[model samples]
Target: MPKRFQSVEARKLIQVSLKTNDLREARLLTGKMRADLHSEWEGRLNGSASPAAYPPDHLDMTLEATEAAYSRIRPKLENLAKQQELDNQQAYDAYLRKLRNTRDDFLRAKACKPLSVWSDLADRRISKNNWILPQGSEGYDTFVDMIAEAAIEAFNIEIARREGQFAAEPSSLVVKAGLKAKDDTAKDGETILDLFDRYAAQRLAEGRKREDGITQDRKVIDSFAKFVGPRKSIKGLTPADIRDWRDTLAALPPTYQKAKAYEGLSMRQAAAKAKAIGAKTISPVTVNKHLSTLSPFLGWCVTNAYADRNPCDGLFFGIVKGKNPRPPFSKGQLEKIFASSLFTGFLREGQEHKPGIQRADDWRYWIPIVCLFTGARVGEIAQLRIEDIQLDDGIPFLLIRHDESTGQRTKSGASRVCPIHSELKRIGFLSFVERQRSRANGKATCQLFPELEPNERGHIGAKPSRFWRDYLKRIGVKSGNDGLGAHSFRHTMADALRTAGYLDDEIEVALGHNQKTVTAGYGRVRQGTVKRINTMLEAITHSYISFSK
Candidate 1:
């Protein structure tokens, strides 16, 4: 009787209601109303009463199941309508209202439209102060969905920040002692696989965004593989077992301490190999990073109940001192490294991809010059694509970034435009990059120096071990603190800035380090102090290397 029932949905309700002489309408309407009230009652979705889109083939079947069940109760509704005919308009009105609510409930759950809205709504809620995600509640569904859709999963990362307090669920101790499994099935066992899986999965899930997480998992797996003797469980892992592994590794020098851990294995090996070449001690920072990668894996085993304790905990070995790290080469040493043609091993008589001439370095024998000139990190150089270099600018410059391997980012986590050294233009550095661009099949990002492949080490591009060692000797570098190492170029530039009257803080920023100088006390790099250092460095270099505006 209401004018609202005249629409297509209303007409269909009347027809379906009359299909079995109104026999099924009463029961069908009542069932739908009950379901509507129970599910998504709080979700306030108001739109034209229409069936929303359901998931493909799978949801198609669920929709049909609900519809089929509705048909079975058609006759009951028809009988109720006839019996209650005296109150026809009032009873029909109530049934129609119930039908709308029931249909709306089915539409929402079956379609998952509410999920998208909830995702948006939940993110807004998380922005509130101290809003921790609900672990396993209906509210958690939205958070989980956001992680699934986002490229970087931040869910598990929230757990890792509370590292110190994290303990076996019921215990308060940080020290790992004998622990029993919380699960009934594993009540007799000494370890908990379920907790281990939960922690590892969280670490693995967050691995995409956090590089540290990947290394953590890797350490856990490697340690587990060692302790299990192949593929056993924590029941077999013991303190003595870990000690033996440590003793074996200790017998060998910590070879990986200087390895180019970030650029991959070949560079890392070259770092260890450089020591024999008379380079000073490989950096402990490098060693520390590798240990960092290894340490968390050890921690996860105990924390997750995979093992009773960390074998690496308080495990101390002789770490090389800080003074041993490569110091900056002086002005005279830098010039010699750049000018010496004898440094290149070049190609031998029988090499497969031999060069016609003996030009051993990339960047026209001046790549090191530009890098030292700019004080740009190796990774920043490695990430430079053809487009990233504005070679056409009358005043050429580089767009530096903290871009990880993904290439979507820049360093410092911000895009910084740095002016190219005037010397770069006069020395034809940009031209060499242009030549590398034309001759190569791929982009400049594929490889910076044509002489070096992606994995080659020691210098800009050359990888031959004997060649690398011999070149260092040819450069007149002192073996034990007399000459400089590969990183000396970077250090050399920092020294150059200091000599020109720039503060230590300025030098730190020019070098692109993201750390506080607490240990050093006085020297710190901050603000745009790096650029000011660069201006001073530009003044210092012109005394030896000439370039025009």
Candidate 2:
């Protein structure tokens, strides 16, 4: 019998029965069980490999639900007639007007009761407006008026109960309303905001652990909500509405544009204010991003039957031609960058020019330098644990992986190991690792760069990327139409490798890219293949490489 394994996540101890007495067979069985345990654990942490499709039962509307609601109102009206006391028709008319005004007050009130109460009030308002007053010869005038007001009061109370503003369970009237409700009438007619919440919740249930993506989605969706009015029904959304919103996004000023009066407003609100102030329009790429995020959200609406179709399905802003590709740092720019005060030390206003890496011991000096050779993402480098840098057969390698326990995630959710470039080794990279290890008493879990903490949104590399962007500005490396930034280091490496005659596969492997063809995915890269990649990485040496003491 093998030792039992307890799962903290499931709170259960797993026991395997090998059903064998032979020692060798039992050992083999135990090894297989351990391997299975590890695979299952990793799968759970990373999320399900394939999520089950949602059932379409949510779309069903039974025949009973489809009947006319007006027919059901007759009985309630008859019951109200039996309870009527007022006989003066003129006085009754005045009383009905008062009820109308009271219902209007509830509708326009700043704070509503619970949703159910509010919805019921809205239903009564509709019914009252449609109710014909019994004229000079007609009878039951007071009964009709009283029933309408009763419905309003009953609904207000239901809202308080459902919204958790009160302790009581739903009233008999509320249950009757529910029983008579159509799919379209239920849940206050499924507003766009309601669908957005459901979409976000479904994504979370599907094991989406990152909030950054959802936060971005909310920004786009919230702007749409503000445009359409929060209570607008999903059924009311049209292609025209989407087009109008798209145009609004296009005319909106860049998010970074600022005005003193709009300081505390949301990004969308600030953009609107800035636009009114005649600020410059945002880039087409940004407008496109808004549409792209919106497309999927609307698609989800369609899937869940909230909408007949996605309004944003076929819309796109045309990107202008000849935009400056984020070009690789020119050879001259690279030289100036490494030789700047950031590397060699320089002075500022009222301050001494502190020279060398020691004065700037954080990401300011190291992240870019590491990026220059390895072409690793600022995020991948920033979140690195000490163990991520390891010696494989006497060659140092950088391991980029997604570890949920450490709140570390990879862009593609795939892990890769790249050999440390020889240039990085010569520049005291190993020495820095040694110091970090000694400081932590040789603990491999220590961060390679402890100074860089995760940002408010929990992205470990977000602030570091900003720091690098500011550094670029300091060195006069403005991000132009070419889309150039820290990521251009990757393009620079790929270009250098191509110039050195490395195959595309070797470059792709070194850069942590997916092997393009089906054949490339058949098996693991040969050890000899890695040796070739390491050679290609070494060839990235510069015409102006200098990191001396």
Candidate 3:
């Protein structure tokens, strides 16, 4: 009987032949040998034991000499381990990308039927990667578990080869990297969800004066969390995971669904239901928005040391410039909009539906019109107060500023004055304001459009946008699946300005865009500048062919 023990740290073997032949005696000898070997190993581990002795002729080739050699090579070994970790990450990302590309090609080649119908095809494709168990099949969970184990085993083997020491457990490595294990919380760092909440709260705190992006960031982070998995470790979130999430986003349905059938379902469930019903997919720009929002949060994670890297750093969805999802309205479309029942006669006072322009100063009536001339965002126009309308030396303009008093939201330096164009004055806008002010009887009403109110989400434009969409449908306008909704009017204004030979700066100023220049940081745009802007805006003229007429 032979008793054998290998020392990983020493890169040496201990072998002894037991003189006894009986099974009981052999077992006793094995236990004794293991205890002696472990005692030696413990001494070596604590740097207290002498190296293995060698023959006089081989004095330089002993275990002590080898340990000295290893000491000289330790830094190289550490570098190799780091490089191996990087290589593993790269390999995993490449494999995931290949899988995704294969799946996409397969779906394109065959008709996209139900999951069950393509089960065999998926199995066949997955087998090419040598996944022992099939995807979407029995013991698939086991397959996933085995793959993770295999990866860890490979990593451990590499560590042992390089360092001449057996690697620690995979869970320990993950914990050391500041990521949680599946069954255990990480001792080093916080969970992704916790970090996300803190990140969101921090943003909210920073933007206490204006919180336009706070809700949007929360929504996008929620989507990212859901896509990756609720309990996934932030430190474990790889580039492969981000790629998978992006692929999932490509297949997802539009956020704004026409049907209300899947209202109460989760985003995942709703997406599945939407696909089942053949609902439209979201645009590349929207997918990019999802990426953009998530990237900053991951960057924040990196800053806080919760994550080593931002997985979404350079990844982007390619957008075709001419294939704009949200195209501006044509002149004909604008005419139809102004000639709609809401503007003509169907709108009535106090009643939701009546025979004449009911709420004359309503946001629903004015926002689209305001968007056409000023190219302002719907939220900005929707949340306007009476005080925002300012008159400077007989010239009237709208001061689109972020006012905490009125709960108006705007991005940093999204404050600019847009001169009220000639078309708005022609449409009785100033007259309507005067009437409302007269009715207020010296007490100023806070809101410009008193009929409009904020929704539960605290977005002033939400309800009005819904109502506008329904109105678009009622007026026989095909609001394209691409973001060409009521907001297209803003695009239309930009196009109109560009068509009229307006400079890019002029257009940016009109839209209250945060100018990225030293001069822009100087002071408020002068009243003279507003007058010039109104001249550029005056070029936006559409001859209405009224349905009422």
- Provide TM-scores for the models: 0.46, 0.64, 0.59
Task: Write model 3 residue lDDT over 205-236, tens digit each, in one string.
Answer: 55532244666676687777776666667877
Global lDDT of each candidate: 0.46, 0.64, 0.62
State model 1's lDDT. 0.46
In candidate 1 the C-alpha lDDT for residue 305 amounts to 58
Residues 407-443 of candidate 2: C-alpha lDDT, one tens digit per residue: 7777755677778888778778888888888888989
> What local lDDT score does residue 350 receive in model 2, on the 0 to 100 scale?
19
How far is 198's C-alpha from truth in model 1 (Å)? 7.0
TM-score of candidate 2 to 2 decimals: 0.64
lDDT of 1 at 114: 40
Strongest candidate by lDDT: 2
Worst 10 contiguous positions by lDDT, candidate 2: 56-65
Candidate 1: tens digits of C-alpha lDDT, residues 1-549:
234433323233322341223323344344544455333322323442333432223222222222222222334444554665435667666755554554455355435644344354444434432344454555456343332222111111212222333331312111011111111113222223333334444554454224344434455455435433343345444556555544433332345433453234333344444445655443444444544554565577677656666655565456765663657766566555554553233454333123344553354344456667777654455455666676332556676654545443433455555567767666677776677678676465645544544332113233432333345664455474343444556677777777788877766666665546565345442345334533655676645643321
In each prediction, how many residue pairs overlap at the backbone (N, C-alpha, C within less than 3 A)? 24, 7, 4
Off by over 4 Å in 2: 1-186, 204-209, 256-260, 263-276, 321-325, 348-358, 479-482, 520-530
When 1 and 3 are scored with TM-score, the better candidate is 3
Arrange candidates, best TM-score first: 2, 3, 1
User: Looking at model 3, which ten-residue stretch has the lowest summed lDDT?
Assistant: 56-65
